[model samples]
Target: MIAIDSSAQPIQALRFEDDGATPNSRFPVLLYQLKLAPAHDNASAFESLFAAHQWTPLWRAGIFDYHHFHPNAHEVLGVARGQARIMLGGAAGQALTVKAGDVLVLPAGTGHRCISSSDEFLVVGAYPQGQEDYDTQRPETGAHQQALARIARVPHPEQDPVTGAHGALMRLWQ
Candidate 1:
């Protein structure tokens, strides 16, 4: 069995610059790892932690196909069930699999897509407080100078969605 511990999981920070095809940048895409395989998984752990951080629950959307990015707000995705290979940073970004019990904290402008997922794959997505009207912008459509500006203006959540303050999020995203 894969061991479970509080020690930081593999943290990946990817910087995506404007590659002409996609306007993704400024804030490096932060993929904070919470144990992917756990002895006991709390399905509601994300909702509770996010509430504590004031990142209001936005919606429960199974990741959609095709790369997409949020331009107006940062987001947190808690893997509630199943597993999937996720493409982050853009269509050309790395492909990583996340199973139940893993959470990803994505800053504004970070592109992500579900390359493939199990039938049961489920994810609970949330956004920072006051920015519930997040827009999904794809790299296929260029001209993001304005979007990048808006992305740059989006502030970091007061606390990490899953870990609250001083968690891997603040350490990495900050």
Candidate 2:
């Protein structure tokens, strides 16, 4: 177990490996944690872990891309500070706003996106594993198409074909 004492050092980062091994099989459990340091530094504790998958906090001041994960991976987002708006489905779909101490779970195949930001900044914890592909039946909406146009400057690595949602696949080491 990794312990991050924010009271002392403030920002801390660690990754826990799964004992079992399989190329494309999902681990029974995946854990992550983020603790805010004082008002000194804005460093992220999970920067290394998220970097492995090219995932990072959307810090730019503008509407961002809406991303959806594959059908096999489950995602859990824990907000440590500030507030964020979670949009479900296409960009113009339903919106759920989350704040500090709130946890949002995205089951496999659930399409989601993020919007809205605060001055306090935000610390998030996300765990994604397993192998799956995008759902082709559900296509992107006109509003989502329009939203994507503005944020086209940023590149999406694992974008889906139909909706252009971004996500990564899990890889196991022998």
TM-score of each candidate? 0.83, 0.38
Candidate 2's C-alpha runs over 4 A off are 1-64, 128-174
170 in model 1: Cα distance from truth in Å? 2.6
RMSD in order of candidates: 3.5, 13.1
Q: List where candidate 1 sits over 4 angstroms from the true fold.
A: 1-10, 35-41
* Tens-digit per-residue lDDT, 32-137, candidate 1: 5566445444446666667877888777768979888888888888887889999887876778898877777788888889999999888889898887899988
Candidate 2, residue 4: how far the Cα is off, in Å: 13
Residue-wise C-alpha lDDT for candidate 2, range 1-174, written one tens digit per residue: 212232222111212221111111122111122344545233243333343444433332222345543333444454556777766544334566655534333333345556666766465544332222222123234344432332232222342111123321222111
- What lDDT score goes with residue 5 in model 1? 34
Most lDDT-accurate candidate = 1
**Candidate 2 residue 28 C-alpha distance from true site, Å:** 19
